[model samples]
Target chain A: MRGTPRLVAALCTVVVALLLQVTVFPHLAWNGVVPDLVLLAVVGAALVTDARFATLLGFGAGLLLDVAPPADHAAGRWALALLVVGYVVGRVAHDHQPGGQRPSYPVMLAAGAAGAFVGTSLFALSGLVLRDPAVGVGELLEVVLAAVAYDVLAAVVVVPATVWLFTREPGPRPAQVTPRLPRRTPV
Target chain B: MSLDTRPPRQRPVRQVSTPRERLEASGMPSRSLLVALVLACVALMVVDLSGGKDSPIAPVRRVVGEVIGPAQAAVSEVMGPIVGLPGALRTNDALRDDLAVAKDRNADLEAELERAGYNDNRYDEFAGMCQMIGDLGYAVSPAHVIGYGSAQSFSDTVTIDAGSDAGLRPDMTVLNNDGLVGRVLAVTSETATVLLIIDPASTVGGRVGDNMENGMVDGQGGFEADRPLELRLLDNTVVPQKGQAVVTWGSEGGAPYVSGVPIGEVSKTFEELRLGTFRAVLEPYVDFTSLGLVGVVVPAGDDQRVIAADCVPGGTR
Candidate 1:
C-alpha cells in the first residue's frame, strides 16, 4: 500500500538504467556485457512485495528497458515476460517459505539471475524469430548468459540494499494486540 | 500465543495470494499474463508474420512506444557528451583532411564558375523544383530540434523548439539532416511534437527518386529489433529495389515538405509479396539515434485539403 509511488519511481529508474546499460555501457563494457540495474530492481521489489506489485514493477521496468539500443521492438513481450517472472518469484517465495523469514540471499540471487537470464534470452529469441530468422539460438543464449551473470553480480549489493530499505520495519508493529480493548483513549 | 495480549487474525485473510490463485483470481487465461503474452506474441508474430501489413496493433504499439521513447532519448542525450568525444576527435582529423581537399575543390569550382556555367550554385534538376516552390508562394520557416527520443524511444521524430508562436502547425512536415522525419502532430505554445516517419503510427506519401515510382512509407519503427526506424513501400506496381532513393512528393506546392529531399534508401525489398501490392523498406536518410539539426516546414494554406486528398481514389499526386 505504501509502495506505489516508490515502485513507480523505481520502475522509471530501472528503465533508465537498463537503457544506459545497453547504449552507453558498451563504451565501458567488460566482456561485452553491461550490468542490468532493472534486474536488481525487479528482484529487489519482488523480494519484499506481493505478486501484484511485483508484476507491476516488472512490467514498468521491462517496457522501459526495451527502448534501449533503439532497435528492440517487442516492448509488450518484455513487459509480459518480466511480469511473469517477478510474479512467480513472489508467489513461490510466499507459498514455500514460512512467515517473517526472508528468503536466503543466495536463493534470491539465483532467482534474480535466472529470471534475468530467461527474460533477456526470451527477448533475443523473440528478436531472432520475429525480426530476423537468420539469428541462431546458440549465439543469443550466450549473450543472455553473459547479461544474466553480469547483472546478478552487479545487482548483488544494490538489490539487497533496496529490499532492506523498503522492506524494513522501523517502529514497533502497529500494536496489533492489547490485553483488553480500551473503552477509549483520552484526548 | 500471549494469553493477556494477542492480536486476533484479521480473518486469516491470505496475506499474499499464491501465484496460481492470483492468476485464477485475475482471470488467468484471457486477461492473465499467459494470454496477454500470447496476444503480444501473436501480434508480434502477425506483424512479422504478415511483414507489417494488416496488423491492427500498430496504434497500440505507438502508444507504448511513446512511453518508452522519452526514456530512451534521455539516456542517449546523457551519453552524448562522453560518447561524442571520440567521434569528434576522429571527425577533427577527417575534417582537416577534407578542408585541404575542399580548398582545392573550391578553387577549381571558382575557376569553373568563371569559365563555364555555375549560375546560382543549385543542382540543375533541383533548380526546377526550387523555382516551383517559390512560384507556389510558400512561406518557409525552418525549425531546429530541441529534444529527441531518449531511452524511451529511438523513433525518428523529434520535438522542435518552435510552435504555433513560431508559426508551426499540426501536420506540417519536419526535416533536417535527412529528407522527412515526420509531420507535426501536436503543437503547443513554444514547442511542437513531430511524429517521425519511424513511428509505428506514421504514414507518409513518398516516391522513388530514380524511376518516380510512388508509394506510401508506413512506419516500421517498433516493428523489428536492431532496425530502430524503418518504412514500408506500398503500391505493388512501383518497381524499385534495395538502393532506390525515397523522397516526399512535395505535392501541396512544396509547402509542407519540398520535393526531392532524401527520405531514405530502400534496403529490404519485399519482392515475393502482394495484397494491394508493392514491397519496399526505407532506410532512413537520417540516423535518428544520432541527430543534431532539423527543420520544420511551415504549413501552407488550407492544409486539411492535403489530408483529404490523401484519401482520394488514385492516392497522392
Candidate 2:
C-alpha cells in the first residue's frame, strides 16, 4: 500500500532470498540442482501483489543474480526470464481484493513450480539464441525439471510466509449496526 | 411527519468506483506498461549478449560483485568449518592410510638415499621448476583455487584467489607441477576466472614430441574424469605415433602460452572420413578435474640471464 514500507519489505525479501540462494543453496545442492529461492520469492511476491510490481521485482532480483558470482552466462538473460515469470505468475495467481488476499498454499506451490520452469526455460532459450556452448537441450530440460521441483518444495515454506508479509491490507470489515433509541419512555 | 419532509428532499446520489474496483476493471499492468518493460528487457538482453566485456552493464556487474564479494567471503569463512566437518574426518582417515604407505616408501627412499647420497626427490622437482623459470625468464605467481563455475551452465572455469592484484592479467598462462593448466580469462581485484584447456572453446597450437610436427589441440567438451583432449595434426605428412608427447607450438609473443610447455601424450587417433586429417586424442598432463595450487605466468622484467645454455640444445655454453 504505502511506498516506503512496500519497498522495504521487497528489498528485505529479495536480499534474504539472494543470500540464501547464493550462499546456502550451493551446499544443499542435490544432483547439481539447488532450489532457486529468488524465483520462489518473486512468485510469492507476485501472488500477493500486481503484475507490474512482480515484473519489476523479478527483473531486479534477476539482475542481482546475473552479476553475482558463479553466474557464467551473459547478464540480462536471467533478468528477462524472471521478468516474464513474474508477470505470468502475477497474472495467473492474482487475487484482487480491496484488501489484498494472499494465495492459498496449493496455488503458491503451483505458481512457484510454474514460475521456475518458465524462468529456467527462458534463460535456456536466451542462452541458445546467443549460441552459448553450454546450453544443450537435454541439459536445459534437466535443469528446468530440477529447478521447478526444488522451487516448489522450498515454496511450501517461503511462499506462504512471503505472501503473508506482502499482503498487508486489512480484509473487508463487518457492517456497522446503529444502536436503537429507547422507545421514548413509552411516548 | 416533520422528519419525513427532509428525508424526502434528499438529492439523488451518484455512485463512484473505489480505487480497487477501478484497478480491477483496468486490469493488472496496462498493456502499454507491459510492452515497455518487455522491450526494455529485450534491449538489455541484446546489449549484454553482444557487448562482450565492454557492455554498459559492466559497471553495474562490477559494483554488485564488489558489494557481494565480501559478504560471500564472510559466509564461506563462517560456513567452511561446519560444512567441512564430515569431509575433515574422512580426510583424517585418508591421511592415516597415506601415512602408512608413506612410511614404507620413506624406508625404501632412505635406503636408496643412503646408496645415492640424496633423500629428497622433491628437491629435483623444485630445481627443475627453478631451471624452467630461469630458462623462460617469466615471473611465476602461485595461486589457489577458490571456486568453480556454476554447474547449471557447465562452464569449464575455476576462480583463483590471485588476480590483478597479484600481477596476474588476462590471457596469461596458468600451470601446475605437471604442465599447462589454462589461461586467465578475466581478472578482478582479488580473483580471476581461468578458462581451462579442456573447455570446448579452448584451442591451442601444439607440436608432437621431438619431431616437432605442428597441430591444433582442441578441447572435446568432455567433463568425464580424465577425458582425453583432441589434437589434430596440421601437416598430415608425419605418421601418427602412439604415446608421443605434445607440447605448445608457441605463439608469436608468448602472451597466452610459451613454447616447450608439455600438453599431453597421444592416446588414440581417429581419421575423419571427409577431412582426410588425423585427429589424435591426447591425454593431458594436467588433471583438469582436480586443480589445486597453480602458477600464473607474468612477464619477467629485464634480467640479464642467458636461457640456460643446456636448454638451447648444443648452442654456446
Candidate 3:
C-alpha cells in the first residue's frame, strides 16, 4: 500500500479502535482498567507504516482521545504518550526488518507491551508534574501494570489484523503469474 | 478488467522500491516531524493547564464531543444488550432475591401508609415537612450513560446522552436512583462529560447522619468494586460509627451539589494519632462500575416549585 490508501486505512483503523476503547471496552473492563485499544492500534500502524507517518497518526489519535467526552485530564497528555509510542515502535520495527516484512507474533506482542508501557508512563509522569490530583505512586504502578498486560493481551489479535489490513495488496491478481524478465546480455 | 490488471503492474513497482527509497520519497525528515509534533503536544498541555475551565481547548473538546459523542451513543445503544447479557445472567438469581425482599418492604410501607391515613393532603404536608427539614428542591433531567473515559487515565468520568440542549451545564449535580454519581464538567449540544465522585480529584462537602456533622468527602482514586471514599470531618472530636449515612451539604446555590442528596454510608473509621484528625471510610451507594440512567439536577424554577408543592399522592386531577 502506497500513499493515500495507506493513510486512509490507518485513519480508519485508529478511529474504530478509539470507538471500541471508549464505548465497548468499558463494559468489559478487568479490574477497572480497559485495554488501551487506541494505543495498540498505533503500535499496529507503527509496525506497518514509516515512523513519520505513524507518528502523525499517533498524534491525531491521541488528540482525539484527549478531547473526547468523558476525558477530564489536560489535553495533549495522550498525544505526547502515543507520539513516543508510535516513534519508538516504528523505529524499532523498521530497524528489526528494514525489508518491510511483518514482524513475528512475539515481536508484535513485545511492541504492544513496550508501547503501552511508554504511553502509560509518559501520561502518568506528566500527570504527576501537572499536579493532577488523580496520579499517585501507588495508582501509577497499578495503571502501568494493568495497561501493559491488557495491551499485550489485545495485541494478539489487533496487531496482526492491522498489519494484514495495511500490507495486503489492494486488488486481487492471478496467484502464480510471473512476468518474464528479458535475458541480460554481457556488454 | 483494467482495474484488476493495474494492481499486478503496481505490485512489482512497489516491491522494487526499497523502504529506504520510500522514506526518502515521502520528503519530510522523520526525526524533525516527531520533534515538531512532540513540541506541539507539550504546548497544548501547557495551554490547557494554564487556562483552566475556560481554556481555549474547550472548543476542541466540544468539537470532539459533537463528532464522537453520537457515534459512542449509537454503539452503546446497539451493543448494550449484548454486552449486558452475561452480567444479567449472573445476577439473575440475586435480582430475584432482591425482588422478593422489595415486595415485602413494599407491603410493609403500604400498610404503614394506610395506618397513617395517607391522602393527597398528607402527601403535600410531607413535602412541606421535607422542605422545612432543608430539602433543596431541584428538578432533574434524565440521561443515559453512553460512554466512559479511557481506562488508562486515572480520572473517572462518563459521557451521558444529555447535554446543554437538555439544560445541562458545567457543575450541575448528577445522581442515579441509588445516590450521588458525579457532577457535570463539560457539556456539548448532545452530550455532557461527568467527573465521577470516585475520582481522586473530587471533593464533596458532606453531612453525616443524625447530628449532621460536617465533613469533606474525598475520592480514593481507582474505583474498584469495593473501594471506599475518605471522609474528614471538620471537628475531630466527634467519632462516627459504622453504617452512619452521609449526604451532601450542598453548595451556596447548589451549582455543583445540592443538599439532601444521599452520598454513602460510613463503612469504617480511623483516627490519625499524630495529626489528631478523624477520618472515616464510606462505601458510596452509587456503583461506579455499572452506571446507566442518571438524573442531572436542574435548579427548579418558581413555577416548578409551586407544582412540586401541589404534587398529589399518585396523579394530579
Q: Give the whole-model CA lDDT for all candidates, comma-separated.
A: 0.62, 0.78, 0.82
- Give the i-RMS of model 1 in Å: 5.5
True contacts kept of each: 0.16, 0.48, 0.67
Which candidate, 1 or 2, would have the higher lDDT against the true structure? 2
Model 2, which residues run further than 4 Å from truth?
A95-99, A168-187, B1-27, B88-317
- Give the higher-lDDT candidate: 1 or 3: 3
Model 1, A30-97: lDDT tens digits are 67777766766777767666656666677766655543444335445566566676676667656666
Q: How close to the true structure is residue A179 of candidate 2, measured as C-alpha lDDT?
A: 94
Best model number under lDDT: 3
Per-residue lDDT for A88 in model 2? 88
- Model 3 segments beyond 4 Å from truth? A175-187, B1-30, B90-317
TM-score pick, better of 2 and 3: 3
Better of 2 and 3 by DockQ: 3
Q: Provide the lowest-lDDT 10-residue window in model 2 chain B.
A: B307-316
Q: Which digits, one per residue and each the tens of the lDDT, describe model 1 over residues B186-282?
A: 8998888878777777766778878787777777665244453444445566667778888777757554556666788887766655465556666
Candidate 1: where is the Cα deviation over 4 Å? Answer: A1-10, A16-19, A22-24, A67-69, A98-104, A128-133, A168-187, B1-34, B37-41, B44-317
**RMSD in order of candidates:** 32.8, 28.4, 31.8
lDDT, model 2, position A95? 51
